[model samples]
Target: MDLMALIQQALEASGKLRDLSKKLEDADFKMILADLHSALADAKLESGELKIKLALAQEEIVRLKQVIEQRDKGKPTYNSEGVYTFEGEVGRFCTACWDSDERKMRLTDLASEFRFVGQWECPKCHAGYGAKDA
Candidate 1:
């Protein structure tokens, strides 16, 4: 069983032990039982705090794993179009943007937007890709 559950069980068991010890006539022996119950209660509280910390750490681990998974999937296949193309993503991406900044900025075909036909450009970095590169 998990440590928190085990601690809870221990606290329950100690409480019952203290209750049963109330039948004894000796005062000093009953005081020791009370002290033992107090320590078990403290242990239960400490276990609860530890359980919260463990949950937060597990969440952090999941977040980091998702980042790693994205990086692995982001490995693009370079087509004959002189640009990087990520899976399930439309259009070509700038190589300089990915290499330098790890950003997947889409490259705009200059033929439709500008005077430079048969050329592409990165909007963020302004890096040009000529038809000769294709």
Candidate 2:
């Protein structure tokens, strides 16, 4: 069973024990029940905290697995033309983002009037590349 379910059960049991202890008239038994209830409450609190940490750790593991899958799918090839492209993709990828960040951000062509005739820019990093760099 999961920690969350166990914690919930412990909470319910503790409540029931508290009610039973209230109805009991014997002093010794009441004191023992109170001690057991306190320990159960403490365990429940720790279990709930552990559940949160476990969830965060599971999320991080999934994120790392996705990064590994992206890397294993295929390595982007360098054309040495100031850009990178995947094996089956037609769009040009940003060299800086791919090499430095392992990202596959596409490069956008700039208008000749605004920049050079064959200038391209990375939308994410804003790195500019010209045809002369090839």
- Candidate that would win on TM-score: 2
lDDT of each: 0.81, 0.81
Q: What is the lDDT of residue 27 in candidate 2?
A: 88
Q: lDDT, candidate 2, residue 40?
A: 73
Question: What is the C-alpha lDDT profile of model 1 across 1-134, one tens digit per residue?
Answer: 98778878877888887788888788887888888879878888888888899899999999888768769876877888778999988988898888885678898878665535448889998887755522
Instruction: Report each candidate's C-alpha RMSD, comma-separated, in the order given.
Output: 6.6, 3.2
Clashing pairs in 1: none
- The C-alpha TM-scores of every prediction are 0.51, 0.73
**TM-score of the candidate numbered 1?**
0.51
Per-residue CA lDDT of model 2 for 1-134, tens digit only, reads 97667767877887787788788788897787778778877877888788789899999999899889879879988776757879878888888888896888889989877575457888898888765533
Cα error, candidate 1, residue 9 (Å): 3.0
For model 1, what is the alpha-carbon lDDT of residue 88? 84
Task: After superposing candidate 1 on the true structure, give the runs of residues whose Cα lies further than 4 Å from its correct spot.
Answer: 74-88, 91-134
Candidate 1, residue 52: lDDT: 92
**Clash tally, candidates in order:** 0, 0
Where is model 2 more than 4 Å wrong at Cα? 1-6, 23-27, 131-134
